[model samples]
Target: MPETTAASSRTGRLLAAPLALILSVGSLTACGPTDDGPHADGTRPSSVTSPSVTSPSASGPSAPGAPSVPAAGKTAGTGPTTRHTASSSPAAGRDPDDPDDRLHQWMESGSIPMNASYHWPMLDTSARLADGEKFLFEEHCGARRTPETDSLARAAWMEKARPGKNDGDQNWLAQETIAAHLQDGKRKASALFGGLAKELQACGSAHTSVTYTTRDSRHVAATIVLDKDTARPTTLHEYLAVVGDNVLELSLWATPYHQDGGNKPDVAWPGPPDTSVFQAMTTPVCPQGKQC
Candidate 1:
């Protein structure tokens, strides 16, 4: 196993929070063509990576060691809603499907309600957030491997982890890679959100809102509304607590909508990062004006 540096660890914490948001909804949804939305060319994107399990190698635990499960019955309410920020808007030409459009006719007809709720153990805790970020990087960005297999691994992981099982070493690789990227300033807000918009567009709409709550509890929100449908799905919601210089406790949430009109289905649990069908997170060696 490769050693992760302290700076890399800090980056993992920050990136983990927001990156967790990106996978939350997608991981929770059921596996299927509808779940794996088509790409811009109307093709299903690849999945995230998974650890090789030829044998149960001696490692720490099946899941990353972190926050203990919340008290058996205690539940956290949906946090307060903050105003939207400007940078959160979707990109140009990225529009949402109209509520009245035939494409979204199922939702527009009201048979699905167009609204749903999803809840988990609140994996946003500092430790889990760090782990989640690591998973995203190793799985999507291919920090230690080539991108070709990384893409396939990501898609496969998403499909398999739909059940929420903790992934082994592969998950750790992803978490570490993401931490390194964020610490290097290669994964800033703009780049992070932009990539998220592109990913969400595959589901149904690309519009998104991002909210960050400071340690002091002050909340900041940013939104990007796709030009097509005008729907504002929340791609990242998190809390940033001061850690050290250039670092903070990052908590994240990613929610994509399959608008089913006024009667939307319950938001599915995207299981775990292990089964996500998306590219790994990586620092583009030479990005073009921040649009990696």
Candidate 2:
């Protein structure tokens, strides 16, 4: 999730690159805390390094074809909007209740939960970036490609829990999720979740470690601590679950650091929230053979 901008200085770029990836995916709008405590700003530094999450051929952020990064204190572009419309008609002689067709329709508009989970605020697609409603095939963590999920229907959503005023200090929680249909869901879920876990493990000097994990037939969740070699390290949580042929993914990123305080940030985070909350959230989206 590295940003895609040239930095004024190498140190600035190095300092910014590690933090840009996920922030770039967000609004990058910096704001001040409305309350009395240290807050984390969901903004990106001026410089960016675009680690190609979708393509491996391209070198790191410095390579050509990297998207341009916005200047410091500016909002990151949300890319083009994409609308996913389920097929209106089924093939001739095919049952109207066809699982694939139902899956497609459910994935296009029915999987995400709008309610808050694990202390995170309610998620709103409208409150996200410009193209927040779009369905995405790309992975947030730098994964080469999701195995066995090509050409499948997918849905994605992202939102910030608390967007404070534009006063340069802020504390926010960023969250996103993806739902898709797979032929071999169990295998596909493992492949998808495994790829993400592998990529996240490479973060930081000692690399991020799995602080907690839960695995069952219905879902798998893992929380990792991204102690990157920077002034502020982030805590990222990811969850993956399978219900029949449907697979769902949820991710959360939060870092509480203030601009004025520099290296010393307030340790007020409520620890990594449980990702299992999404396991139940996925059932209603793609339950059994019924369309949601």
Candidate 3:
């Protein structure tokens, strides 16, 4: 069967299972606040563009009409730009726009397998970026050696050999699955973007916008913005990727004062980093006490 068709079928079965029941209960109760921080009423502001997914067949890195990179020396604060916000909906309710709903449904239906890769995009990003500039340096510099990259590559290979991870499971299957998918040739950038959109929507603020593009005809660019001050208290940005219908990957970034009220003494520097391909990917993983 075609992958989409099979995914649809699996979704149907998942919606009918115990996991679905649990998610339904949790979504209704444990999610987040419901007040629209900046853009309420389910309507995104005019300043922002709706989520977009560009398929591999449509265009590669040099595709015309793709979102352009910010000009050199331009800062994020030079003018108005779209921002991201967390979901404000009650936790127990189903996110009407959740892209992972299908995956969650499948997991609930008991389709989850043991020792499968799970891709957790949001957590992965957050964990990598929690330390700010240090984290950023590692992601872009490859200054440190870690098992995550190799582990993720191995997980990707294993996915074809067995059932993949399920959504809502506490295990790190989602991240592993995404790692595996990124290494897979068949996976497209659009699928990754689509999965990111779903995960962002589930957070509920409706002010977040995520965009991906090719930076300088080489690197894949991922950007997120938080529009509201209220939502900014929790997180400023997150990066995500989709491995498959059931797998997603993610990372987080924030301004220094995003969580605490303590403001930076100097003007905030914004825009993408200045680095090479090898540096950009590993800059956020530098070990503590090491200079990136």
Candidate 4:
């Protein structure tokens, strides 16, 4: 089985456009360890390009409509991009049920574990940038629509795991640039997550969009789909993975928000998508963050 993913990105008021599609997050490649390695200040780079597990798509990072925040009027990045007491990750062999095994539980814990079969897992190594498959949605910062408020210091991590036997019961996908940051970053993350979560459930029978910021201060854009009607209603869950300084995000889709009731419309949208590399909306997962 393959991992469920929803690709996305943010620029200003609009989210990176790649988010509009299930930009398949094929097997991911690293931007070289150093490209995503920790900095003296404990901060990661603004944008990173991970390798692809599958072949590159005709439409990739250069996909038109990807959002970005420009300089000038863009809001400032919040929190401590300059300092932090970097902590070690729990050993992969650590006990899963052991509460102590969740040192970076704040990162994602099991919010979006890979399904049973697929053993392929890709890790994200940035507090503020896209990781793994999210490499394609990268956007620069600018004078676009960034969160106006300042932010607090934050932390983040990423992974692309494959799950086998998606029994539809736990058959959901997600894509996130979730993180734990300063009050300001928290607010921004909250706004983007909350905004998308609310709308994912309300688009009765329509599609939606995604938006966020870049490390360079740019606004971005993405997209969302509407109401699902199937034996297993498409359920989408969007939230912040915050636990103290370790705040992160989870864009999981387990059930439908606005499941169709009355009758199957003439054109009942197909229930979600397949187990392709990248997933989207009810059918897929949110890309990076709002951006992803």
The deviation in Å at residue 49 for candidate 3 is 80
Write down the lDDT of every candidate, Cα atoms only.
Answer: 0.27, 0.42, 0.33, 0.32
Clashes of each: 54, 5, 50, 92
Per-residue lDDT for 1-292 in model 2, tens only?
2433433466787888868886865644345333333346654444444434334333335347756555445565432221122322111122323333222222211222222232333333223321122222133333344433222332112212122221223333334444344334556555554544444444323645555467655555666555555557665555655554444555545564755655332433344334435634464565556653
- Please write out the lDDT profile of model 1 over residues 1-292, one tens digit for every residue: 1356877888889999988887886775644355346756787757733463222333334445543333334444322222122322212122224222111100011111111221222111212212223233122222343343233222210100111222331111001111222322422433333333333223233332322222122111222222334453333322121111111212222323445532221333233231111111121222234443
State the lDDT at 291 in candidate 3. 49
Over the stretch 55-122, how does candidate 4's per-residue lDDT look in tens digits? 23233344356443334444544324412223332121333354433333222323233423223122
Quick one: best lDDT, which candidate?
2
- Stretches of candidate 3 exceeding 4 Å from the true structure: 1-178, 181-194, 197-222, 231-250, 255-270, 273-279, 282-292
Q: Listing every candidate in turn, what is its Cα RMSD in Å to the true structure after a full C-alpha superposition? A: 35.1, 31.7, 33.5, 33.6
Indicate whether candidate 3 or candidate 4 has the larger lDDT. Answer: 3
Better of 2 and 4 by TM-score: 2
Worst 10-residue stretch by lDDT in candidate 2?
155-164
Q: How does candidate 1 score on lDDT? A: 0.27
Give model 4's TM-score versus the native structure. 0.26
2 or 4, which is superior by lDDT? 2
